[model samples]
Target: MSWNKLLCNLRELQLSGTLNGGQSFRWEYNKEMDEWTGVFSKTVWKLRQREEFLQYKVIGSLLQSIVQKKNDVEFDNNGVFEGLLKKYFRLDFNLSDYYTKWSEKDDLFKAACKQFYGIRMLAQEPVENLFSFICSQNNHISRISSMVEKLCKHYGEEICEQDGVTYYSFPDVEKLSTPKVESELRQLGFGYRAKFIQKSAAQILEWEGEKWFAGLQDMKYKEARLELMKLCGIGPKVADCICLMSLNHLEALPVDTHVYQIAAQNYLPHLRGKKNVTEKMYSEIGDHFRSLYGDYAGWAHTVLFCADLKKFQQTTDSEDIKPKKRRKKT
Candidate 1:
């Protein structure tokens, strides 16, 4: 209901490179309006990039907690949203500093910095991150986004209906834990991933909710990964993604097909001869990037990953990137 403008430079925080880089899903780009509309946490937000600043509007808000408090314009407090935007965008982490440090070390990262400079890692909600990555197996960005959106639309709480757009909250674990939910997911075109999401949700509930997942946040990376692996359908890559994107384990590198090919083609040519990225190679690749990129290896890897994706397919918008180019089916 409230229209607002955030003054971050378009260069310092480009939505095209940052949000579209495939971290979180559900945002939709309106080409005509030049705006991106999406829900994150319980808020339905629309953002558009202008030359000097980004204009945003809180189109709708969802009810969170037992209070049933809605963040609509009638009760709108810009301070609450100000905090959310700052945290979501991770403004505390200076992009210019990262660019300077990374570009100085490696030419590839230097080149990556120039293209995807403002591509900061989003601080996603951990529960949503867990469920979202489960849907990512053998999936493209668009499919994953669609699956997540379907999950919200069907199971997630209905926040509001505005201008024919209905906003729903990401479904709670209780909503997704049932076998019925799994069956419904298949009907929704989730295919086998429906089971993965259903089982993963149940496992978290079995672990007695966020306490266990939050525990991983404090764990060492190896232990953190092993802990995540215990969940059904979670593997090294998925666990690593959860760790890096949500759990604050910046060194976690989720090696997928794209990373493997890029490494072989550019960084490690010996990998070119290998038919597949074996377990050993995966660890080696992760370790190599860690050695190369240091503490924020995962973030650096993502920048390179997005750069590679942008290179192969001229993806100026996040919607344009797809998983067909992903090395999974190959």
Candidate 2:
């Protein structure tokens, strides 16, 4: 249960309420307080996620939140530590099989998969996830994250400050389900996504809407994803992201530009030439990965996605690539 030696690179994990599909966050540790506080946990739950192995420090509030939430359960470092370890590292799907198959060709990809992509699981919060993905359509990460932050700051409650940083809690249904708020968000630069987020929030706040979302909880993976797609700003890819990350549907595949690139060069070469990517093609590509890697389709997606990102960064002329210096033994 003691995780003093377990996790490292705490920023990689998406403890934030919104899943932007990009692993970029803003959290700084307070050495004096010895507590990690931010909008989300911002604690790296997976230890083997990075090339360098470092000691994992326990954040007091995050552990306390879990303990306090559980009825009749007392707060103990051991119990809290164990709960987090299980939550992050314990995979319902097998990784060994996926890793072995992926590692066959490129050793670099294998290492990238195991180290970076493997641990970066999506934590999807239904409403927030829905809006985040909506914000992501035909948009960039920097812009998407900024828009999300704007919405949260404008609409969400100001929880408290930690180390001079003000962290805004995610807005609830009540605050977001109004026409006035939706209009304000549009003015704040959400553009098309603002309308969808506002309408979706309004629907979720409705009486019948609760039942609709509740029903999705017990539905099958495909059914649940399909149901989510009914909401405004919910497309096939967006719905799949919500299902896999937030709804606990492990096999869900959310295709985007990066995944499309992988499908072209790596997976399906013939489909690469298509000018427009259709639903049938996307489903076929998902099936291909599922068939080849079996249950680790999501895992493979993460691996390939991260590998593609790294390759893209390396090849881009805008960014400078420098050699990584080796750390000397302590």
Candidate 3:
């Protein structure tokens, strides 16, 4: 298959950080090929980065015909795919501009930018983002990813098979809302999250059907977050996550334990030594970031969050120390 190109800079968007950085859990990296394969918008995609552009290939069948009709666009297949990719990665928003503004206001963000550039927030589909985060409570990324994969394998429709591995689209609300889904998910090792997934799906269907999430984009941030919290197992944090990631509420920040630590150490020292983040503390942390970074506080929080991750820390440490050791030897 021919690789299609999207003009993108490495400094503006890094696939390594954005794809696997706990936002969405579907992407799998192939070390040898240096590419990522994932499913979204009912299509499987393989993507890699070149110096000045992103190279991508459609792996299997696509459901973009509906998208084309909705947008009333007569573009070719590649054009439609390109539009989807742009929307998914949110390429319209200039990350460099945000980085400049963030760095100017906060010294920590300025420091984080040294080693953590190109961490863009993904504009994920609301249905996928909702359930994926429902699985994230008190869990790590690796396990959350496994559970999400199982959901697709069991409930989602098969898109295609590549290299002896099958890929499935994330199941729609109707599919997940069936009476038996909860029990089946528990058997699949979803544990307590199984109920959340099934109940949330059923709630979506009952409240406003599949198109309900689209309505959230038109609401204010606080209003949208409250609407999400009305679902089972969705708390303030998960609600904020869905709001920022899928609902286009850029100011919404999800204050989890990791985020709380970051806030305590740098932004809110008064929160230091606090064992748990209370509801009030959560508001404080998020509000501080919003005050600091303004509209795109969640996006800024992601950059700092990525910088604090052990994976990125190890990479930064290696790069920083290797050259210094070489210099000393020389």
Please count the clashing residue pairs in each candidate, in the order shown.
0, 1, 0
The TM-score of predicted model 3 comes to 0.91
Q: What CA RMSD would candidate 3 show?
A: 6.8
Among residues 3 or more apart in sequence or in different chains, the pairs in candidate 3 whose N, CA or C atoms overlap within 3 Å are none
- In model 3, the runs with Cα more than 4 Å from the true position are 64-75, 310-330
Tens-place lDDT per residue, model 2, 1-330, is: 243544433333422211212522223334353333334432323222233323344433333654567855666665566555545434333545556676774564566655453345644445566666677676655566577778778887665554475556667777888899777987898887788888888877774655666677688888998777677777887787677665666677776655766778876888776766677887888887777655546655765565445544432221121110000000
Off by over 4 Å in 2: 1-38, 41-74, 77-98, 101-117, 207-214, 314-330
* lDDT (C-alpha, whole model) for all candidates: 0.80, 0.57, 0.83
RMSD of every candidate to native, in Å, equals 2.8, 7.9, 6.8
**Tens digit per residue, CA lDDT, model 1, 1-330:** 556877787667878777777788877777777778888878888888887777787766653332234433344346667678878888778778877887888898897777687887888888888888888888877778788889888888887777887889898888999989888999889888888888988989999888887889889998999999898888888899899988999899888787888788888888897877788999989999899889898988888888877755534454566643262321
Clashing residue pairs found in predicted model 1: none
> Where does candidate 2 have its weakest 10-residue lDDT segment?
321-330
Poorly placed runs, candidate 1 (over 4 Å): 63-76, 314-320, 323-330
